[model samples]
Target: MEIFPAVARVTFDGQVRSFDPSVERTEMERGLPKQRLLNSQVLVKQSMTLYFASIGDATTFESWYFDVIKRIGWFEMVHPYSGQTIKARFENGALGDLVPDEKLTGDFKMDTVVEYMR
Candidate 1:
């Protein structure tokens, strides 16, 4: 799968701006009387945000993304940072927020964050 192409497009959202994804590794640990021991260590979450810049792009993105949010499932994407294809979904709350900047009346940008377990 193609990782982050300087700029890339997805099956759902076309022509997007993406930055390096955030990958997290988390574990549970406990401390003993004399030493420390690890309990559970595993990859926790991988997250990335895709930006839809432009009113037309934002509108299309909103429709597609909100649709996914309504359903309870994961979508597919090529992770930008890890260079791997992963099953991901929109981050828990507030799927997409589109607010027009002062410079343009209709021009706007919206960012959608997604998370994956890999």
Candidate 2:
């Protein structure tokens, strides 16, 4: 018998972190006719912001960080919170500039708006 280890993480092109991937969803609805639902737009392909936080004492700098941070294209994402591996694209991302005196470690955070591609 074969088994896989239980892993909870957020990953992009190999950069991995064992943390909750915050998934945001837009309530597609109209403010009329008793607030009707607009549509059930696949759920994944709708506009969303992915929140990723590093584990304690860990640096945000990863080998695949740049490619994920700078590149503009669709990529696969493993969302621990949603429990689904979905296709998404980077709409925007932000990180405060690392200072000389400040240490670069732990809980380095970034929130990005990603539109599901597939």
Candidate 3:
């Protein structure tokens, strides 16, 4: 039985990103890991902090950040610049994961996914 993981495609600021990877599970567990998958899609609204490591003074760029989905359904990001924090609500658009998974061994594969509100 070959079961494939679900794929999530998200768009923001007129850009579309796709995430295709398997959900993580422990050796003793039979279900997916509780953590959000890397490359998973999410939504972000205005007033949300888009964090990035600037090249000198430039602030924003096309990049990816690992964000956490809050219970209130907002996305929180730690500004890589100021070290301050910011958040995006479900009202704006969507966010997604763009990080790739690391292959530990030949048969062992572990990855993460993101959650979003639509």
TM-score of each: 0.50, 0.36, 0.20
- When sorted by lDDT, best at the front, the candidate numbers are 1, 2, 3
Give me the displacement of residue 21 in model 1, in angstroms. 18
Q: Where does the lowest 10-residue lDDT sum fall in candidate 1?
A: 1-10
Writing each residue's lDDT as its tens digit, candidate 3 over 41-112 gives 444322222222222111112222222232224445433234445453333224333333232222111122
Q: What is the per-residue lDDT of model 1 for residues 1-89, given as tens digits with 9 covering 90 to 100?
A: 22232222333333343433343444547543343433333233433344434666766655554554453456666666555777765
Q: What is the lDDT, from 0 to 100, of the residue 38 in candidate 1?
A: 38
Which residue pairs show backbone clashes in model 2?
58-106
Candidates sorted on TM-score, descending = 1, 2, 3
lDDT value, candidate 3, whole model: 0.30
Give per-residue lDDT, candidate 1, residue 117: 51
lDDT (C-alpha) at residue 68 in model 3: 28
What tens-digit string does per-residue lDDT give for candidate 2 at 1-118?
A: 1111122123342232232233444555665333334454533323322223344212333323454345454556655446676665544533333322222333333333445532
CA deviation > 4 Å runs, candidate 2: 1-65, 68-70, 92-107
Going through the candidates in the order shown, the clash numbers are 0, 1, 11
The reply for model 3, stretches above 4 Å from the true place, is 1-72, 90-93, 97-118
Worst 10 residues of 3 by lDDT: 1-10
